[model samples]
Structures are given as structure tokens and as C-alpha cells.
Target: MKRPAPRTATTRHVTQINRTAILDVLREHGPLSRRDIQQRTGLGSATIERLCSALMEEGAVEAAGQVRQSVGRPSTLLRFASSARAIMAVDVTEYTARGRLVDLGGSTLYEESHTFALEGQDAGAARIDGLLGLVDRLASPETGVTAPIVAVGITVPGIVHEGVVTKAVELDWQEVPLADIVSARSGLPILVENDANATAYGEWHSGALANAHSAVALVLGARLGAGIINEARLHRGHRSAAGEIGFLLTSSASFSRYFTEQGDVDSTLAAQVLPFAAREGLHGKRIGPAFRAMMARCRAGDSEAEQARDEFFDSIALALVATSVVLSPQVIVLAGAFAQYSEESAEQLTRRLVGRIPWVPRIAVSDLGFDAAITGVSALTIEHARSATYLA
Candidate 1:
């Protein structure tokens, strides 16, 4: 047998891995003495000291004073310097661009929201300008945040591939090079992700799904979108469309129609009571007030409103059954305006879902609400900043 070749040196790679490990430990466990880091990382005391010294010199870690031991000299505690750098996160919605300046510990340093007209001439350019202005406002010296911005993470309502928006029906955008354009203007590393995916990642990182092994975050609004997490990792399938559930067809209509047309609870209620409203000479009332009146009638035992409510529950149950069968997530998180439903509606939907699906995942309403996507993107930016330090 031929003699095996000698192993190539991997000292640098091992050192990088250990450095990252040390930083992660510090971040998770808070400040730790050098001895504590050594025990947690299984690295020798000398190696830990050497790495910690380098990190401290690089402004990635800092000594937080000393702890007196029982029998030996006091040991100095070290912590990951969470405020050493900052991240810029931008969330692009239908008509507003929201930005937040965040630190490594996921703390918001500053935030601003800018709204733009979506139907005027050069609307796309106006939206881009709005986003850039938001970034400029947050990153300016006037904000009093001394940390340098290391990266930008943008969450958009579209199919993003390698920082490009393949399609965003809401924005009427197609094949838009969003990341390159933003990077050119901002001069920082840029990452663009689908809004739903970002929200799911945000939930996984720090929200309701943080401890879940798998989850699906569904954004229910005029359009339906989903972000899937498997084994604690965001599952962006081939073409990054793993959770595009809007196109999934049901018996009544596509899932998107449920929230967009007569299938949605509010819209269905409006349609059912429109005849009643017209008969009562309430034709001038808008859908909002009509929806409220319909709900009131349902509470007062109106047969038509009750029928509409039952049909809405049935449609939602069918949609949930389809989603659960395919993804089988440990939990399903509901975000967007639909989360404002009354407790009775939630209970009814839950009962319907439990009756339809064999294994009913826990249904959760998002606490982050409108900030979920921005928060998730901010977390991604901080993660990128942390990785860059290791390379440095």
C-alpha cells in the first residue's frame, strides 16, 4: 500500500474557527473570565489568552474588570464588544421605506421611516431615493452613533436572487438589480432578502420561533407569503422560492384570492352584507365601516353574516391544511394586518384547523408586527459584521 501523504497545515483555519467559537460563546453567555472561556471552548489556557489578546486589540472583545477567585489571583472578565460596529437595515414596503441602525447585540440605535408615492411618474426611482435618504439620515454623524456601519441588509417584497429582485408584483418591479444599486449608493456590503423570509429569520433569531426546530411564518394580507425554517435554518429552496404559497391552488381559489378577493374574512363579510347595506340605503358606506357593521350583525345573530363567517373559516382551514401537509412545520406564525382579528375569530380558526389537519402545528401571532422584516434584516447585518471581524 502506498504511504499516505502527510497532512497539510490547517493552523490558520483552526485559529479562525476557534476565534469565531470564542466570540459566539461570549455573545451567548455574556461576559466570561478567561478561565471560563477556556472551559467553555475546550481550548488551552495559553491559546485562549493569545486569541483573546488579539481580539481585544482588534476592538472585538474588551476586558470588563476582574473577578476575585477563592484561592487564586483575580481573573479578568472579557466580553464581545457588541457596540464596536453597526448595521443598517432597510425594509421596503408598498409605499414606505423603513430603516434602522442596529448594533451587534441587536439593539436599535436609530430608526426612520420615509413614505413615497407609488403611482406617480418614475415611482421606482422615487422609492430608491427614499431608501437612500433613509440610509443617509441614519448613518449621518448627526445621529451620534460612533460605531462604523459594516453592512446593509435590505428586505423587499419580491423574489430576490443574489441581491436582484426577480419579481415583485406589489411594486411592479421585475429583474431589478436592487442590491447592486443600493451598494453603489451606500458603499457597504449589501444583502437583499425576501420580506417574508426576513421576517421568518427574524422570528427564528429572536422572536416567537427562536427555540423552534422548524417553523413557517405566513404573512397574511392582500397577498400571501411564507418563510420556512427547517432544523433551525431558513429553507430557501431551488430558485429561493421555498415558501411561495400564494400560487398554491385550493378548491375555492388560489390562496392569494382568499386574502385579496371575496375569500378573505373581511372581504367575505363585506360581500355578504353589501346586499343588506344596499337594501338599508347604506350604499355610500366604504368597505371598512361595512365590514364592522357586518361583524356587528354576526354578533347579533344575522344568518347571512354567520354563513359568511363559516365560509371564511372553511377557506382558511383548507389553506392551512394544504400548507401543513407540505411543510409540516413545528409552528405556524401569523403576521401582518390579519393578526388584528378578534379572539373569537382566532379560536374559530384554530378549531377549524385542528379539525382539518392530522398534525396541527401551534399557531402563533407575531409580536414584532410591522417591524419583523426590518428586525430580521438588522440581525443579518449584525451577523455579517461579526463574520467580517473574524476575517480581519
Candidate 2:
């Protein structure tokens, strides 16, 4: 049912491979002499020199400084140019829009945000305008990001499939052709991802799970969910609904008055534990404070809080165990709100999985914190920029 891929390895292809190799080396370990690059990449002296020259001409690599050798004249040390180009990454929530302009080497150069209300008949159109306006504001030359932005990557708080947002409850959006619209309006390539997936990829690629090629990231914010990376790839499943762990059942109560739906973890938590938290005199504008208080109480040795915490872990443990049995990930990463109590959360989840699974995966906490998604979107944009028709 599938067509075979065409095989065509021309001289150009080999040159491209060598070029990519040189760039990768420079990115991983830079400020090295030409001889050092030859030694590391196994490329001949002529090829390394040629590729480095081309890369420097294209603004991807530049001279860091001169290093004098004991036996020869001062050798020029080369490094990947972090500010050669820029990537515009934005995160869109229900009420807030935050964006950053990052360089090629994953450094934040500038960031900006503005709040807007999504109301009335033209809310969808207004949302689009608001997003574009923010992009224009950040892209202004006054922000001081001088490099040309090659691509843009944005995260939406909903299901994104095939360049379209199928649904976003908080934003009241459906079947929005987000990527096409944005790319057309901005005159650059666009990448669209959900917030949870973006967070998971950001953590795995450069944050908590950077060392682990395959890991599971649990997003335990006001709403609970999971992001999965398998063999260094984001596993979106067949319909792009792979990591929706909020629908997992912890107790018998999920069957009655609780159906498996999108982002149902918060509802499940409230049904099972909020009553106990309320009884303890914890309330706030949103569920975040009360939930945080409950987690704290449980760690202080409160019986009721511990019971509720265990129940909460029950739901999460089901997802982790299932993910472990299937993918055998190297680690389980705690992200979002739960990351604040990563040690305790990891301990509780480990206790639940000690005997159930043949072996337990190590648990880690995300280091990027609230910036994970933005970092991830920026990385994705860089990748797209490299593979784009234009030269890096």
C-alpha cells in the first residue's frame, strides 16, 4: 500500500551530508581549530576547509577568535554563529499571548506579551488579528533582534492536526486553518503544536530529559496530561491523540459521572480530591492555589491529604506504567505545576510502580519551568529553517 522511496545519491547529496556534519560538530563543540574539526568529523582537510568557508559565507559559522599553537602560527578557531538568524516563537493561551525572538543557538533575545479578551460574534477573527498584531509588535526592528527571522513556530492550547486547530475549548475555536493562515500572513514558514506537546518536546530536547532520548513528560498543571517521546521522536499516535492521560481511570468513580474526554484530568481530580481540599479551608480564584496547598499538606503528613495524593498518583501511575510497558522509556519527567514538588511526586509514582512493572523508569523534573514551550517552539523553528529551501 506504500510506494517505495526513490534512491538518488548524487555528488550534491554527499556534499550536503559533509556540510551538515561540520555544522553539527561546531554546534555541539565549537571554538575549535580547522585541524580539530578534521580530527572530530573524520573529513579530510580540504573538505573541512571548503565546508567551513561555505558555512561562514552563509552566516551559519563564524570565527570565534584566534588560538596560537606551539608549533604553528595562530590558528583561527571557528564556532556556530548563534545570532546568524532568528526564530519567532509564540505561545497562545485563552487570555494571554506571549512570544520570544530567539537566535539560532537557542538564546532568547527579546520577549513581549499583551492581554486581549475573546468575546462576542467575531471572537475567532479577533483572535487571529490579536496573534498577528503581537507578531508585528515583536518583529519590529526596535526590539533589537537584528537577524532575519527565517521561520515562526507557535503553540496553541488545543488539538492541532494537519496545520489546523480542530478544537480549542478555552478559545472557542474549531477547524481553524492556523498554520496556513499564519504563514500566509507572515510570509514565512509556520509550525503549529499543542501546548502540552510543545512542553514535552522542549523538556525532552533541551530541558529535563535532554540526556534521555526517549522519555515520558507528565504535565500536572491545573489540568493533567502527558507528552510522550519514543526513540527521540514525538509519538502523536494515529490521530495525534497519543498522550491524553487525563482520561485514565484511577478508581471506579471514573465510570460514573466521568467520561473519557479531552483534558478531563482536572475534572477527575476535582471529583476525587477537591472536596477534601475544601474541607481543609483552601480556596482561591482558580484551582491552582488550592491544589498546591493540598499537595503541600499531604507532604506534611496529613492523613486525608496523603490519601488524596495517593489517589491522584493512582491515575498518573496508570499512564506511566502503560507507557513503560509499551515504549520502555529511559525516564519519566515531571513538568508544569507538579515540577515544583518533583522529588515527592517522583517518589509517590515510583512506589506505585515498584512491583507492577518489570522495571521502573527514572523520574526527572523539568528545568525549563514555564519557558519550556517557548524554548521548544524556538528549536522546532530552527530545524525548519535549516531544512528550508533557503541556505542557513
Candidate 3:
């Protein structure tokens, strides 16, 4: 095949960037008059008008009535066409694969989950098929959704470089051309990203770290991952392995053991505490019940329960201190299952880290929960779709 002509510093490319900028502004703070857009974007009135006209014509933006003025004609207000298109997002975890259809505004239109074995010869194919099936279900006309899926974004727990999974220990994957396979099978443009980076972007885009120009998102669960955002951009290191903090070795074991071992409150309560508690005459196996029981015991000043919770917090705080020293981010958002900790536990963890580090970053917990990765991927996919020449 003949190679396509290399792109140059053309007027069209510049216009496209400007258009994307306008869209971004509207997406963030919309229902603005053209003058407001001009003021916020520092673009000429004529340029804003031209871009708005094109965007409006393409169904990417729409006039949302007009802004009333005191002494002049009302100015037309423009807003992003958030419902005009949608993107499919898939998040592959150690034990499950989750898929969701989301719009430009990060609203979930549909979501479903499938459990799969994390290791074995068929694990990889099973995950791929599960994701494809989820997309098919969302796209089916029977679902009554009319918005078209313009792109697909998949977040994997590993190093993803140019759509390939260079390594994903959790899934036993190596050098898997994930994006190519998904795009070929689903017939839609695909973007593959590291799960931690995706989660961080998700939190930055719509969750706790939205206001931070520099932030670190630590996902503490079966796997410990960190996503770094510097100057409001995801900082993927030289080899796209920037957030694999799980591999960091500690004095006793890998740093991941702090979170992956019986350190997670829910997992610990379910796997270890519950069984032991049952043997000791407190028979509750469910996480909810076990967690409540543990908290109750701690509140009553039970030494054993408090000690367990304290150790968990200490382990997490140590990891946070390490991350803070390295990144010096303005904010650190804790995500994944560990975020389900009670407010007291979270505060305790924060308190534990107060004197450990010289600089303290505002620590927050993820509100998006397990959906962070998929949401971030959806946002990324939408960005790619918006920037594509064909989409423009």
C-alpha cells in the first residue's frame, strides 16, 4: 500500500486543533455565548464563529437558546453535543472484565461485567470475547440506544505501548497486540491504555483530582498501581511503564504485598478475618457484614481489630510517602477496592502520613470506584475521536 502523505503545518490541522480546543472549553463550561468562548479561549470572534458554525453543522455543538443581555441583543449560547456520540470502554482486571457505553460527558449509558479466570491458556481469549460480547450487547438495536459508538478504549493492567500489552502479570499477558485485535474484531477505532493511567485520567477528568495540575492516583487492590499526572497530563515514562509501582521491592517483600496481601480491608475481612471470626463464634462471611463487625469491634476499642486496621493504614501510608517523595504531586487520590475504607480509616491513614513526609499533598479517595479505568478510557477515546480528521 502507498504511504499516506505526511502531515504538515497546514491551516486545516491548525483549525482542527482550535476546534478541539473550543469543544474542550464547551465540554468543561458550556452554555456560553460566543463572546464568553472568545474570552476564555483567547480566540478571535471571527475564528470562534467560524469554528462554532462548523461544529454546529457537524452536530458536535448546539445552540442552547441565548444569554439575555441588559442593553443589547441576546447572545446565542453554545454547548457541547454530549449526546451526539458515544464511546465504548472496557476495563480488564485480574478477576473480571467490565464494559460500558459512555457519552462525551462521562455518563454511563450501559454497563455490564463478566468474570473470567485470570490465569490459564484460555484467559486472554476469554477476556477478548467477553469484551466484544459486551460491546455487541450495547450496540444492539434492542437496547434502544440511538447514539453511535465511534470508538473503543480498553484499559489493561500492564504496560501498553501503541496498543500492545508489553506485560500484564495479573493476566499472564505479554506483548499482546490488544488494540489491533479489538479494532479488527469490533470494526471500530481502539485505544489501549494502562489501567492505572486510565484510572488517574478518569479521576482527573471527573473525579477527586479534577483540580490538580499535578497529581498521583494510587490504586490499592489485588495489584498496586500508580498513575502520575504532571501539568495536567498523564505522565507515561519512557517505556510506558511509569505506574507499575507494584514491582517496587520493599525490605521484606514487594511493595505490592502491602495492598495485595491481607491488607485490603474488605478482602482481609472476607478472606481472613471472617473465617477466623466465624471460628471464634462471629459467623459472618459477607464483606459487608464482616466489615461492619470489624468496625464495631474497633469502635468498642477492641485491641486486635484496631491493631489490624492500624497496620493496614500504616502499610498504605508508607506507600503514599514513597509516592509523594518521588512525584511530589499536588494531590494524591487513592482508588480501587481499598478506597472503600471508612471515613475514620481514611482519615487515620492521612494522619499517619502527616509527619512522615516533609511535604503533604491533599489525599483524596476515588468517587468513581471500579469505574475509574473505563471512564478514563472513555474520555481518551472521545478525545481521539474528536481529533481524527475524518471525525472533524
lDDT of 2 by residue, 1-392 (tens): 99999999898888878887887788889889999899999999999988888888888889999998767799999998878888899988766789999888788899999676665647766777889888888778989878988889998766788779887655667889999998888888899887788888898778888867788887765456667888798877766767766666556665666452343555656655666557678542223445677787877888988787777777678778877898788888887767678888888888899999987999887788888878777787787776652334
* Candidate achieving the largest lDDT: 2
Cα error of candidate 2 at position 208, Å: 2.4
Per-residue alpha-carbon lDDT of candidate 3 for residues 334-366, written as tens digits (9 for 90 to 100): 777555563565687679878788898887878
Give the TM-score comparing model 1 with the true structure, all chains together. Answer: 0.83
The regions of model 2 sitting more than 4 angstroms off are 1-6, 10-15, 32-51, 67-75, 119-126, 249-267, 273-290, 293-307, 389-392
Candidate with maximal TM-score: 1
Q: Which has the better TM-score: candidate 2, or candidate 3?
A: 2
TM-score of each: 0.83, 0.81, 0.75
Model 1 misplacement above 4 A: 1-9, 70-73, 251-310, 342-345
Each prediction's whole-model lDDT (CA): 0.77, 0.78, 0.76
How do the candidates rank by lDDT, highest first? Answer: 2, 1, 3
